[model samples]
Target chain A: MMKVLTANRLTDGIAVWLGANGRWLERIDHALIARHREAVDALEQAGQSAFHDNLIVDVAVIDVDEVDGEIYPIRLRERIRAKGPTFRTDLGKQAEFQQASAA
Target chain B: MYRYDEFDHDFVGQRVAQYRDQVERRLSGEITEDAFKPLRLMNGVYLQLHAYMLRVAIPYGTLNSTQMRRLARIARDYDKGYGHFTTRQNIQFNWPKLSDTPAILEELAEVEMHAIQTSGNCIRNVSADHFSGAAADEVADPRPYAEILRQWSSNHPEYSFLPRKFKIAVTGAERDRAAIQVHDIGLHLKRNEAGELGFAVYVGGGQGRTPMIARKIRDFLPEADLLSYTTAIMRVYNLNGRRDNKYKARIKILVHETGEAEFARQVEAEWDKLKASELKLPDADLRAIAAYFAPPELQDRAEGWAGLAARKKDDEGFASWVRQNVTPHKHPDYGVVTISLKPIGGVPGDATDVQMEAIADLAERYSHDEIRVSHEQNLVLPHVALADLEKVYHALLEQDLATANAGLITDIIACPGLDYCALANARSIPVAQEISNRFASAQRQQEIGALKIKISGCINACGHHHVGHIGLLGVEKKGAELYQITLGGSGDENTSIGQIVGRGFEPEKVTDAVETIVDTYLGLRESAEETFIDAYRRVGPEPFKEALYGKTSRAA
Candidate 1:
């Protein structure tokens, strides 16, 4: 299993995942992946460091799987966090880019 | 309806200013999340799954037109154009920014509302009967006492950091509309043999991972002793409540461990010391507070009796709505109207800003300027003349707020589970939507009659599943959503924790399981008048279990 570091940004509490570019991204597809044990440890350390830096809150290292070069969180909770609330798809990060930005 | 005095205004303003400063510091990285979490929580700000959620308290579930309008404006401006009405009768904005919360609090304070003490290990909002002054079954209005408790408990230094959060609910009717039996402290206002008003006090009832009914500690506590007795219970619990593990911290756990009778004795011994102190309320003060809740002078709209019947005959929709969503008022010409937020295949308690503004307008014009948020996740016009109901129904239909199921099967109570909540193991809103859609037919629902299906994403039971007639508790089993069903629970006067029936059902199969339970209940029922609860109570869970699972339904 692979892992990815995730947290909600401190200002607006929007869910974000640590990306390979060393910046938090809203879409989980671009998140930094850790396929080995040592890489997973590095991701956990990065989550703690980001949390301590006050850039994010509720930091976690969640399990993920890559299929056909697409990343998907193993748990439904994380999946919802990555996309949007299953009940109101029109309101969360999964909404249209312009509409979500407007919100 | 209580106006903010100079002191109230000043207190709320200062708190808002304090929160503004705290938010600024956190944004600038001068304060850490660990240090700033409790401060924000005290102001009702929470960091949820996708965004920061702001829970605004509606004291005793009462709000005037102006205050409600302000909430609508807040929903439009700060949130994503909608808000969730919680089972505790509070409204939550699911997408508030941490930085904008101070301004939201400022707007709320301008209307004599605030998010103060909505969270934290303190006395949360004091809830009262939604039909306190209007219900036909009358004893006395309970909101004044609830207001008094609100005043006494706000920012109290001694009780601010209790072992766990505390809740107090007050209801005046003997029918128990407030679900007082399921609160940390349940106060039932009643009349003694001499016709003097007092309360029947029940303590330690709560629902969570552990569900327990409160014990009747005192049958009739005099009206003036409200503060004294409450303080005594608080002091006893504060001193002895378990601080070892957070899960076992509620006073219900204490009452269970030390027998309910002994817990009452401890509270009594503590009360003996504080009964004569300043805690004893004065008659003048009580009267002064009660004056604020004086009912509006209702005019004689007696012609509504004939006009309403004719109107109902003209429109079957209005007649069915009248049968389900209207409750008789104390005044013969008036009726309490429930503006159902449960539109078929729609979210349970999420009202759009436009809908909220429309309700505010309706309350201002026709409902004595009063609005109530019920624990069942519906907006209520506490007093509407029967003659105006036809007009009100038409207006509600425009806003998609005219669902005729108030207590029926489609009228489900659901929490913001994994959808927005951080603690939920499964999704509650979708489950509620599925179940509601399955039972969407109004005719079928009316036939089922007064069935409460409460859903919770986790064992915390914020959705009050432990007390629902048909309770569904969602858990994560092997990383998938599983719902366990419970039978025969209720939150009314004779409150009982529902007993868990057979094994769990997967998400795809949960709705079918619920339909099976409802079908089983309908078959065993003696008559149409026998409610699902009555039929279940008459013949225990064996029949329901056998229907759910053949012979293998021994126990979970």
Candidate 2:
């Protein structure tokens, strides 16, 4: 199963994915996927350091799959977070990402 | 529309400044999350699932046009262009950042608003009847007394760190609109035989994991002794209330364990000692507070407006809306208009930035520059001229807020649930949306008159599910989300806790189960005039139970 590290950015409380070289990406698709045990260990270590550095809060690992070259969360909670509120399709990062993708 | 004094202003300013420094310390890692959690919660900040949610108090659910506009500005600037009004009559912005919270609090203070005592173990916002002064049935306005309570409890040193959070609700009318019976301390303003205004105090009422209707501890308490008596109760609870168990620390638990008689005796003994102290509310202060709550002068016309009746005759949509959404005012020419926040298939109690701005505009123009947030999760234009109803209706329609389902089934009350709240076991808004979609027809909703469907994401009962005529509580079973159904609950003059029916249903089957319950009520009702609660009261829950879980389910 595919996995990625996620946390809320400390400054803005927005969901961010762990990206290459200790960077946090707003878009989950840009996340640096961690598949092997060694990679997962490295990701966890980086997450702890980020927390200690006061860059993010409540870091966790989330399961995802690359379907049609698009990353999607496995759980309903994560999926809803990724897509903004289920009641609102016009708000949140998902809407912004979709607009940018279409453009 | 009570203006804040210099003392109140300075106090809020100091609080905001102090919180800013605390936030700075937390950000710099001088304090851990555990150490900073309570401090953040004291300022009404919560770490929700998606972000940091900020709940700002609209004290007693009353605010003016300027405050409402400021709220709109905050929604546009700080949050995701929207805010959710809660059942406690407060508003929550779901996407605030820790760094921007100080700025937000500073902005809120400019309009005489703050998040003080909105959360944590303190006296939360003192809620009052939404139509306190406007309603014809009211004996006196409750907002003045509520404001007095707010001033008393804002940041009292002794009661700041109670065993658990305390909630108080006040209602002045014979018709209980504030759901006072389910609060920690419920006060009903009434006049005694000698024509002296006093309060009938109810204590130990709450609806979380343990739902209990408040008991009337005092048949009549003198108006002058309000503060002393309240302090007495608080003192008793603070000293004797349980602290070993968090869930058992609420005053309701103390009252339950001690028995109502013993609790009343203890409170009375404490009150006797404190009554002679400076806590006794002075008549001059009461008069001053009451002056601010005097009813707005309304123009006298006939019993009903001719223009509105004509418009109702001409347009079906306007007619339906007027029938459902327009409530009677104390003045003959005016009406209390409730702008429905529960639009069909939309999230309950959510208003976008534009919608908030439009509502503020409406309040400024149609009403007396005053707006009210109902505990039922709707906004009210407390005093609109009946002649101007059509114009106001059109304005609301333009903003997509003119949904004509005030007390109907579609006007469902739901918490943020798992989608946003960290404490929720399952999602509630989706279930509400599904039910709203299933019963989309306005005519069908009208046929099922005054059926309240309240959904709670968890046992905390933030959605007031325990008091709903038809309640749905979301619970997690194994890995799947399940909903438990309860029937015949009400939050009125005669408040009763709903009895849970047997067997929980999967998310896919929850709406079907709700429909089955409603259908059973529809079939078994004696007349169209008989409400769901009335019908359920007449014939017990057995028929509905059999319909949901087959005839041999043994729900009886």
Question: Which candidate ranks first by DockQ, i.e. highest?
Answer: 1
- Give me the TM-scores for chain A across all models, comma-separated: 0.89, 0.88
TM per candidate comes to 0.98, 0.95
Q: Among these predicted structures, which one has the highest lDDT?
A: 1
Q: lDDT tens digits, residues B449-512, model 1?
A: 9999999999999989999999999999999999999988999998999999878999999999
Residue pairs with clashing backbones, model 1: none
lDDT of 2 by residue, B231-278 (tens): 999999999999899999988999999999999999999999999899
For model 1, residues A1-103, the per-residue Cα lDDT tens digits are 6999999999999999999998998878788999999999999998889888999999999998876677878888998888788877777777844323211
Candidate 1 at residue B145, lDDT?
97
Q: How high is the lDDT of residue B461 in model 1? A: 97
Q: CA lDDT of each candidate? A: 0.92, 0.90
List the candidate 2 regions with Cα displacement exceeding 4 Å: A1-4, A29-45, A61-75, A99-103
- Model 1 in CAPRI terms: which quality? high
